[model samples]
Target: MSASVKSPRDPSTSFDDDVWPDSTDVLIMGGGPVGLSCAIMLAQRGVDVLLVERRDFVFRFPRAHLLNPRTMEAFHDMGVAGDIYGATPAHDRWRKAAWYTTATGPGRFDGMKIGDVPAWGGGPDAERYRSSSPRAFANMPQLRLDPLIHRHALAAAPGRIRSRQEVVAIEQDSESAVVSVRDVVTGELRTVRARYVIAADGGRDSADLLGIELEGPRDMREVVNYHVSMDLSAWSEPDALLGHFLHPAGGARRRGTIQALGPTHYNRDSEEWLVSVAAWMVEGDPDDEAALFASIRRMLGLADDHEITMHSMTRWSYHGLVAKQFRDRRVFLVGDAAHKHPPTGGLGLNSGIQDAQNLCWKLAAVLDGQAPDGLLDSYQAERRPVVAWYTAHSLENANRHPPIAEALGFCDDEAAGFRGLEVFVSETPEGEAMRARVAAEVAHNAHDYSQLGVEAGYHYWAGALVPDGTPVPGDPSDPVTFHATSRPGHHLPHVWLDSATGGDGGSVSAHDLIAAAGLTLLTSESAAPRWRAAVAAASGNMPITVVAIADDDAAWTAVRQIDDDGALLVRPDRKVAWRAARLPADPDAELTAALETILRGGDAPAGDPAEPYLRRIRAAANVLVR
Candidate 1:
């Protein structure tokens, strides 16, 4: 197969909704990594979901190889991170990404040590991630990962995932969305009425139906990817780990320029590999298979006798686009349908997974009548800005690569010319200076690998969150370094603490204590009974659980940064919704008011002059009791 292979039919061009044959709380329109993730998240909350995909089976092309720590955390919450980890290549072999001139011999470039273990997050930063969450980043290509995600999603909600099913048309009213779907295998058409339609359909028809445009640059660059399987053990040292292959400029056998992708295979010991040739790095048509093969062979410095089986070759244009709106009435867009970015920072799939995590719980809450419908609007308000930041960061990273090319003597500087391989391989003074410059450039590129800040430090403001009038100092827009904080709207900082179970019990992550469905309240040991009493007084009215850490837990206290007598309200997505530095004099009144405001989507109640907020709260309580 090659890049010219056609995709499956468009699933949102026609509507024949004459017969209604199905109904579900959520109708997921795509079963890629993000759709599967949305299904798992919703199913775990006991939300009835139907996931449909146009493709009959999972695609085998390897894409999005790096699953960042934040993505792994979502998998951990879904209880499937371990399964994903088992499928990934060994971390020790793939974590340290470096640049090599060729696959064989002593062609290692000096200062080519781009970063340490967890190529996405280097040594010290990776250690910080370990302390915060149980999951670590891993390198598992989409070909292997999709099936695992599919299996887990199926297991989470049996008989709900439907393959070869395409959604052809969607129309939504105030109450529900009616979708017309066609069975790809049988040419059968059916109608489904879903309370909400989640369009994770990979940036195609669904986005157009909702009149949403992916607004940004789509022609940043073009690149050709070659998926192959070949034995390269002769070129690697025993137990050797290989990552990025930088085929520097000017080699006798080289056809223009090419670079082999590392981390696509299990390791150098494995036969599976995916090599890429960026169009910006070369001067020939990337779609030409013969030219691509010549470049690959030249980059490998291998003999024609070597065997390499080609699986597929595909050309993709790099993009940095996000949908104009993530939601439209009863339909919502997620995953690639919501945003698209180049793979430079590996943010695309991970951001989509997190988007699913964020929206699913809110949907579950609204569908279950635990929270008002207005809460749904916060999804766009919170996610759009964060995704926009990620988009900019990825584009910046892609632009940064040209500087590396310039340092390696490949740019259009006629005065410098092509230095050839000798600059990186030879030990002469000129070679040593080139290595130093390359090393300095590599050091400047550290943000690409050590992006702990981007992985964990995102915060939400003005949506589904109540500010306590405390000003939180702003950090850098990019992920240079992470600052741990439990401020309102920030994610709850992770800390290890002794279980409130007793004096001689095991320890648990503060993250582990958050409610999977409702709001969670954290208080000091002395205020436990008061908070519990306040919650009980408001019982049947609000969904909340109270946990009090012993005042003596210094580590937990410092990380949370809250006074012993204060309280912190955590949302289902593990973000701080509100916090009180100290107990309010009227805890019950304060707690009731907060719950009412949050449930109304962080707005005061409407239309009633007689205690509208209180009246709505009572009405919801009465409904719950009924």
Candidate 2:
């Protein structure tokens, strides 16, 4: 999985359409994390998929530094969460973020703690809540992680993921998409026909090709990132990534260096550095290396004798944008292709990965004849709002400025300032209330996955798959915010339960339980008989698990109460397709209606054996060729 490994397939080689299958179930246009996740999900479901990437190999950029809990859950489902955990470099989970008046200014604030939770017990369930099993936010750089994902995708489907294949054109009719790709290294063109095409080509290329416009602020200022090697033990504090070198007088613009890269472990050999510096613009010849070198030297407090090694220089603009639509006909967009946000929150890559996961299961269900054709529209319905939410939130996070010290009631009068400090810390109710409010605000600011359930918890609220009731307030369209309560259409809350009901209290992880059940129908034991009977009627037609749980756990209890009769039917993609107090007598018919409502575009439901729809589509294509 080294970054230097080249593509195994020769550029001169063209996959012979006559020798192989004439069409693919899905064509994925980027081999990055998003596309790779899509490929893995499809291949896992036994779908014929073709994945192409313009890059010669896996990503080497130092982007996407953290993996939140929701993403960990996704990796768990993929069976690679452990591999990712093992590969990540060991580092302190709780680190500080420093902010300065300016990029070069002296530090105005100390370390600000982000995310940390205290342990309550020791077990898988405990780990799920407290242990950071999948890492709520880990510091492993994407340069090291992307290769692992790429390898996993290729391993998931041998001879499926094609590297160095640049997609030049995509055309789709009502039934299939034809894509033209050129081997970037060999200059050979090949046509691939697929039932669906996913464009993960980021914003620049795929957006333009699809005639999609990105509406948002462009880069008003250029930020330069440098990966460098240096010894900062003399001045740098441990675990401090941002160091501000404020102006001596404190009234002028401050400038400082942002630590963009760090060692996975504390090993001296493993130690590397990524520094970012920003300014309005470089004066006196923009290309002046001396100016850049001087900025680094001043920021780092470097001495004349200090040795330095620079790895790479990258320039990025602060572009915040979302595509008008994630899909146009058979072609769909995900990840950076659908949206781009400021990297301040490290949500871009993680959000993109979620996008892939959301789309993958629906695509698999449709292609595998498990779900109807209309099910595909829900992909856009559910994910587009998420992109918009994260983009706006990320922009807000980027723009947030630390509270000025003066705002803490400190005054110019030295005597008055001391009195103010005493009152602020002492028995004054106002002072105590202010302090508590500030602390609570800071804790609230800590980005927790409570909102993740919203992002990942998204349910289809539009098109044929629209859920019942007035769209749940803040359903998929609302901005993501941390809320402990589980709302309808939100990600099923993570809770540990006693897996062994008859014996002593033994707990199992929520993720493990869900995976074991395959497709979980969470409802009370009282409803199990009816649900089981309903599922039995559709026995040969659908494959799902009926999980009956007591209304003891808080989240599930709330879901049960609000959903009525404690019965909720969850799709394989972990979305709630239908929920009711009891299954109808004709359970198969009711289930069919729900499925058709979501997947059939209000057209009359398909007759028995939904397999014919998929078969007919493919068979008709073959007839056209004949």
Residue-level lDDT of model 2, residues 143-165, one tens digit each, is 77778778887777767788888
State in Å the error of residue 349, model 2.
Answer: 0.4
lDDT of 1 by residue, 1-626 (tens): 01011221122211232323368889999999899999888887778888888886557788777788778878888888898777765555455545555565433442132222235544555677676555678767787788888988878867778888888899889899999988888899888899999999986779667778776666556677778777776654333333454444532111122222344444566667777765544446666656666666656666655677788877787666777788999988898898887776778999999899889988988877777788888788778777877776666655544444556675434324335344655788887877777777666556666677787777766578777776664555547667778888788887777544324565677887787777889888898888887777763334687877888887788887778888898987888888888889998888777777676667432332222222322332232200
Q: lDDT: which candidate is best? A: 1
Q: Scored by Cα lDDT, where does model 1 land?
A: 0.70
For model 2, the stretches where C-alpha displacement exceeds 4 angstroms are: 1-22, 89-93, 100-135, 240-257, 266-270, 281-290, 402-481, 484-486, 500-506, 515-519, 538-542, 550-565, 581-590, 601-626
Per-model TM-score versus the true fold: 0.85, 0.75
TM-score of 1: 0.85
